[model samples]
Target chain A: MPQIAQLAATYSSQIFWMLLTFGFVFFVIGLGMVPKVQSTVDARDKKIADDLDAAKASSAAADALEADWRAKENAARSDAQARLAAAKADAAKDREARLAAADAAIGEKLAAAEAQIEAGRGKALGEIEAVAAEAATDIVRRLAGAEVSSDAALQAVKAVI
Target chain B: MHQFTIEPMFGTDHWAIGGYNIAFTNSAMWMVLAAVVIWAFVALGMKRQLVPGRWQMAVETMTGFIDNLLSANVGPEGKKFVPYVFSLFMFILCANLLGLLPLGVIGSHAFTFTSHFTATGVLAILSFSIVLIVGFARHGFHFFSLFVPHGTPGWLLWLIPVIELVSFLVRPFSLGLRLFVAMMAGHILLEVLSSFVINSANAGPGWGLMIGVPSFLLMIGISALELLVAVIQAYVFALLTSLYINDAVNLH
Candidate 1:
């Protein structure tokens, strides 16, 4: 084969060029470029991890804030319910007292009215009796030509008439 | 045979060192081309985006492949040898594939430097030298224990160590020869089949239809196989180098 035949003629050049070029590849690409690529990958991995952590922290914080707001809302709702219940009870008590006072005052007024009516009726009856007695004395003196005293007439009216 | 010959690109005696005809040959040109191609592929693809582009991904995939191979074969300590192994793997892989480029249609043939034993031998020796250096540096004289398999019987020690020692010494040659022979044989087979296609077609329509078509189809299949071989050979070289380094480092 020419490969073997040409060995003496070409081996040195092949080796020399191979060494020079291979050395260039080792230094420039292997040594210089590889580390940069690795670092880039490393940096990307770290960034992803960091961003994930930050997202988790933010999500937790949001959940905590929502929980805090929920707690506050529940407390406020309970407080408003308590206040509303207290106001309802106070209004009921005030209404009951006012109704009782009004009822008592009306009863007192009704009683006073009834007493006035009784007094007026008594006076009217007394006046009516007096007037009838005077009328009866007058009738007796006219018909029989006799003097009839007011007391006697009133006694007759009370006894027979 | 002429395809395998390495003639100077410039004048025959233009470039030399120590009077040993180191003229700038086609083999040297291809080697340089492969190296440049590898450098550009890596350097240009390094956009360093957080999300890599296709080109950058390709570059990283290659480096990551070699990295994982080393870590798998040689353990964690193999991390330090990434650059060397990366260079070796890329160089051989690019040289192998570049040789198979269909540039013959353009009347310019690609020279496969890896098909030369001298070139592959140099690569194997380099890998072997690293193993030797690391073995001696780390384990001192105990590095020779690599020749002794763990838990060998006392009676078998005499035979096993010698056999192991011979196998260990043959690694560089075997490594070099494997790649060289694989690459050279694939190319020769393709060339031979292509010659049959040409010669039979030139003979007559009957011969062309009978032998040329089948040979042509076989060449296509073998060419695809050659592409696979190119990748597998590069992988095998790197894998063996790492395994050898593992034995050197761990002495097992």
Candidate 2:
């Protein structure tokens, strides 16, 4: 056909150039750019996931530390309460012993005064009764919350000496 | 005066190139003249300036024109083809300008050129062939398939192939026809006009000379117009080829 002949006449050079151009593009894209693009995308996705995982783990650790601090605070509060209770009990026992010792000393002084009054047959017995009575009065005054003390009266006697 | 002659350069006893019934023609001279003009313009533009003269400015137009054209139409990736396009523009431009010269007529021994039908026809084909080859290589056999657009109904599938074949068939025809017609028309016009001018000059006296001057001026004007046409036709031929290739290699 004349058309065929004309086409051939027109396109001979084009046929040659096309074959070379196609081969070059195939070699460049199939072997080079495509594979590189795929691997780079995969690497990027993996990196993102890894960063997210690391972030999650760190946040979890922070939560755990917060929980631990709350638990330790509760333990310290209970321990302080236990120490305070023991101190209050010790103070109460010390106060009761001091009160009992004061009562025993006062009772012993009254009994000694009565024995001196019954056994003596002179003024010494009367003086002993006076001393017992004074000691009982001072003890009653001390028990009733007066500021006067037996040491102040003794200080005056010592000053005369 | 320069010697001009076309003493049968090729043929089987006088036709064709390298071998066949083709004769050497003046078009070849014009082609050379075009080359020199382009070279001289480029040389002129490159010299003397931080600021370019008009000659240099004209030469530099190619660099900017093709650069912008390719980048805008095909994206910056296609800018690589600028040199080929620029050269194509220059060659045709030179050929058209040379067609205007009266150096190669029969009356003038200093310059005369004539082309056999085969020579003129073949030269036009040669330029088209370059475009076709480059495009096909750029896209491959896929280039041939470019005629058929994707997404047609199954019932219409048969028509697609026929349409594609017909479209494929028109490429070489259109490309060759445009250049051949333009060149043929220019030569025929120049030949007919020159004949009239010669005969008219002998027909009268002072009036004959006076009429001849205007006729000569018309020829000169046509010659300049032909120069512009030559470059433009070459560009259209090349650009259409690029568009065809773009269709083949890229869908958009």
Candidate 3:
């Protein structure tokens, strides 16, 4: 009861200090301190999000570069195969032309040699006939005292042969 | 007995103005001290770090706690009342802790300003006034309809409203008295137990250990309980304020 009674004498000062102190604290905290702490938290969150975005972008770039390199490599390989095929075709054509020319030159040489040999055999047979005619004429004269013509003797000799 | 007395800090026996006492008393000093301690704590605690230390953690924890309490009781709209509710909680909590210290330089025992009704009554009245003002501002005359239940029978309507009105009116007093009495009683118990130990020790050194040791241990336990009660009482004060504001805003 005495504590209750003391309220009348002490109320004003207590209330005054309470208001002053509480008001000061409210402004300092509600306006100042809380916002600072909140900003830090927000900044930390923003930093993490930015880092993740950067990582995603770099990975995408790497994937694109790898795809481009693989495509170029495939193109180069196909180009080399095409060139090799063209060179092989050209070499085969050149070899076939040379073989055909050699075959034609050998055939011409064989035809010329056969014609010359035929002419020589004709000449040698004619000479042998003349000699046989001469001998036949001499033998007829001595045995029968009658003379025969070269052309006739040759004909007779030929008929007998 | 002497701890409850409110003597002027200065030499004046009588200080008055307009038939009211405006004398600066020990209670006022402790109130100032409570404010200073809180300021120092927050000032030291707020360093704007990505990773908070102990002091910053403490400040942040208290802030988040009050925020949760406000949001839970009054929804998102409760955020506007953070300044007052936060101030009320911190002030009461600091006063209670300050009272527990060996701070009574002029009295026979330690003193706490919150143990007095005059101080706590002012805060309770202030909180109740906010509820009433805000309720009327938001709902106008419909605020009075809070006393009338939705399903009250015609025969019992008169009785229920009367009871409701009485309860509503007594809220400030109840709120004020609850904190004052709780703080006062805990401190008194601590005082009595410690005195018993002192008395036993004065009886004889041998008797001191025999009787005083147990009593001292019990006092230590009570002190821990007092510390718990201090925080709880502060929480209750803020919770009740939020609830009252909720009732005013929603008419529930």
Candidate 4:
């Protein structure tokens, strides 16, 4: 249509500026902000990965230390048990030696006392026999006259024994 | 038919500023009215209510329609440029639709046609720049290689520049022409058909009714066609612009 032709004819002059504006904005976005966006995403990803690695390493170290601590505790417990058994054995030996020494002393004292009582009993028996003989001789002398005293003593001794 | 032609005004009384003709023009008045209408639509669209009203629907339809269309065509990449594309589409659409409006101010005062020429020129320049800038922004100097393409024979290199230059140069021409032509055609058709109604009305009553009804119907159809054409032209203009920029910025 002629109207279209007129429209086209009218707008011919504006083409240059329009083209320029498009070119300018194109350069601004392409060369400027795109790289920044990419780098930011990259940096964030790297930081997250680093943190995860650090956490894993620390936990591994902690686990290793815990294992070591358990081993040491096991060794200490065994050593303590051995020491306690040795101490108990030494205490039993010492008690037995002390009890044996005390029993020996008691036996020696009893034996000495028993031997002394036997010797005293023997001496006292001999004296008592002698005295009985004398008394009996005296009694016979008083009852029967002088010459018959010997025979009387013998008979009195036999009766007294 | 009325005399319809475009010639630059040049005379003692004709004012010229910076080598561009300065004259009161029909295109200028139409563009002003279009601007007012668009502004009103924008204001109405932004009434900021939870529920969208009719005026807001009108604005959203244009924006959402373009958004969906681009998303469908170019995927996410098209969505990034929706605002710019929508604004550009709206401007072009308004220019096209304004031509359908009756061309008298206060029912009598006729505007100068020089203003219309400048406004269309400005729009063409704007759309051309958007394509250029958008492509370059996306691809940088790499955009320039898009014109050269890939896998061409050494002998074809000469043809490449020629084709590229012609295509690039034609960008603004197509944009400006598409809107101007559609608007101009719709207005002319409506004028002719309505003139028949006016003339036939003076004839016998049946004659008037006979022509009037058909003319009215034709006008309505043409008006609808104009609406469709207006949106199509704007889309074509922007699309070609983007395609050209894509050519300019892409690498093989």
Candidate 5:
């Protein structure tokens, strides 16, 4: 083959040019340019990680704030409930005391009215007895045409009239 | 044979150095072309954008591929050898693919430099030299232990080391010969089938219809296969080199 035949003549030239060209590739491109690309990739990765960490930190902070607000809201709600219950109890006690005082006043006024009616009835009965006695004495004296005493007529009215 | 012939571009007698014919040849031209192509490809992709465009991505992918290969094969220390392996891989890959370019349709021949033993042998020797240097530099005389597998019985120690030494020595030859033969054979097969197509058509219409058409079809199929082979050979070369470096670095 020509490859074998021409080996002694051309190998040096091939190797020489190959090394020169390949040397440029290795030194200039591989060493110089590749690191720049790799560093860019590295920087992007670091930025992404940092952004994620910041997001997580902010989310945690927000959660803590929400939890703190909820705790304060719960405390205030319980505090208002306690105050409302206390006021209701105080109002109920006051109403009961007032009702008891009003009941006592009404009982005292009704007893006084009953006592006044009882005294007036007794006085009216005594007057009616005197009028009847006088009438009896007049009748006795006119019918028999005899003298009749007023005290004796009152006694007869008290006994039978 | 004519396609494989290396014609000195500037006449053989005019470019001798130290009694060696150092005239620039077609193989040298292709090597320089491959280098230029690689340089342009890498230089154009150096935009350094955080979000790489397609061209930048393509360049990054090539370098990253070699980096990962070394990382996997030779471990962390393999990082130091990335530039060399990247250069080697790109050079061979470009040479192989460039050779297969259909430039013949435009009356210009593409020389496949990797098809020559001299070129591939030098590449193989370069990889082998690095292995030897790294082995000795890292492990001193213990690098010789590479020829001896662990847990060998005393009786088999002599025999095993001999076999291992032979295999180790054969690595460069095997590496160089594998690429050279594959590239050379594919080109030769394509050329031979092309000749058959031309010769049969000239002989008669019936022979052209029977042999020429089928040979032409087979040539097309083989040409496609050759493209795949070109890529595979470059990958295999880089892979084996890294694995050999792995042995040197890890001492196993």
Candidate 6:
């Protein structure tokens, strides 16, 4: 009963101080501490996000560089292979030209050797015919003791020899 | 037993306004002390780190717990009331624990303001007033519909509103009473048990050990429980405030 009874007189003073304190706490804490703490948290989170983004970007750049290098290496290899194949084809062409020229020179030499042999054989056969005609005229005069013409003897020897 | 008395901390002939006992009494001084202590606690604990330390973790946990309670009860709009609820919870919590200190009760110095109905009642009234003002402001005349239950018989509707009105009016008393009674009862129990331990120990050495041990153990257990009660009462005060505000905003 005294508790209820005292409340009438006591409430005003209690309330005045209560209001002052409670209001002080509300304004100071709500406006002051809450926002400060929140900003710190947000700043920390932002830094983390920025670091993560940078890491991802650098990794992607590295991957792209590796890919470009591989492509360049492949291109250079193909270029070397093409040059090698062209050199091989040129060498084959040069060898075939040299062989054809050698074949033509051998054919010309064979024809010249056959022509000289034919001329020498013709001269030797003419001398042999003249000797045979002389011999034939002498043999006819000795065997029959009859006079035979040199021109007729030579003609007969040319026909037989 | 004498610890619950209200007396002026300083001389009687000091500051008084208009014959009112505005003299800085034990109650008012403790209220200020509690405020200062809480202020130091939260203000100093505001050191922000990505991974919180012990003090920051405690502060953040308390704030986050209150925030979750508000969101659950009052939805997002309750966020605006965080400072008020924070002040109320911390102030009451500090006051309750300060009263349990080793300070003598001759002047009732450091008496918990929450143990007095006047202080707790003011908080209840403030919360109730917000509920009324917000309910009416948001819903206009339709706020009266709060007492009207849905799917009632037309004849019984009149009786239901009367009951509802009484129930609604009882909220402030119940809110204040719950905090005051819990704190006062816990302190009274501790006082009684501690006195018992002292009295038994003085009876005789042999009998003192027989009875005093149990009494001392009980007192220790009760003190631990009281500590738990202190935290719980603060939580309940804020939770009820949020619930009332929730009803005002969301209806039902």
Choose the strongest candidate by lDDT. 1
What is candidate 3's lDDT per residue for A1-161, written digit by digit as tens?
Answer: 44867666667766776666666766776556655554554575687889899999999999999999989988998898888888888888877888778777777777777766666666666666778888888888888767999899899988986
Deviation of model 3 at A65, angstroms: 11
**Candidate 2's fnat?**
0.00
User: Which stretches of candidate 2 lie above 4 Å from their native place?
Assistant: A1-161, B1-27, B47-54, B102-139, B150-153, B200-228
Tens digits of lDDT, candidate 5, B1-252:
888988888565368678766778888889889988988888888887877899988988887899899999999999888888888898899999999999989999999999999889888998999999999999999999998888888999979999999999999999999999999999999999999999999999999999999999999999999999999999999999999999999988
Count of backbone clashes, every candidate in sequence: 0, 15, 0, 20, 0, 0
Evaluated on chain B only, what are the TM-scores of all the candidate structures, in order? 0.98, 0.68, 0.91, 0.69, 0.98, 0.91
- Give the clashing residue pairs of candidate 6, or none: none
TM-score of each: 0.79, 0.47, 0.68, 0.49, 0.83, 0.71
lDDT of candidate 2 at residue B99, scale 0 to 100: 53
Give the clashing pairs for model 5.
none
* Local distance difference test values of all predictions, in order: 0.89, 0.54, 0.82, 0.59, 0.88, 0.80
lDDT of 2 by residue, A1-161 (tens): 22234333323322322222222322432233323333443465577889899999999999999889989988998999998999999999999999899989988988888777666745665565556555655775779866545556444334543
lDDT at position A35, candidate 4: 30
Better of 1 and 5 by lDDT: 1
Error of 5 at A101 (Å): 6.6
| Candidates' chain A TM-scores | 0.72, 0.50, 0.50, 0.60, 0.67, 0.51
- Cα deviation at A2, candidate 6, in Å, is 6.9
Residue-by-residue lDDT tens digits, candidate 4, B1-252: 232443443332243456644443343444455545555666556554444578655666665665666566556566555555555665566656555454454474322221243445565776577667776777887676766766868999989967976877787876666555555666667779988888888787898889988998888888788778766777786676555444433433
TM-score of chain A, model 3? 0.50
Per model, the share of native interface contacts recovered reads 0.74, 0.00, 0.56, 0.06, 0.73, 0.40
Off by over 4 Å in 6: A1-9, A45-161, B12-15, B47-57, B104-110, B148-164
Docking class of 4: incorrect
Best by TM-score: 5
Superposed on all Cα atoms, model 2 deviates from the true structure by an RMSD in Å of 17.4
Residue B152 accuracy (lDDT) in model 1 = 90
**B69-135, model 3: which lDDT tens digit per residue?**
9899999888778767887899899999888875445654456888888788888998999999999
Q: Per-residue lDDT of A1-161 in model 1, one digit per residue for the tens?
A: 97788777777887887777788888987798877766776687899999999999999999999999999999999999999999999999999999999999999999999999998888876677778888899998999989999999888776654
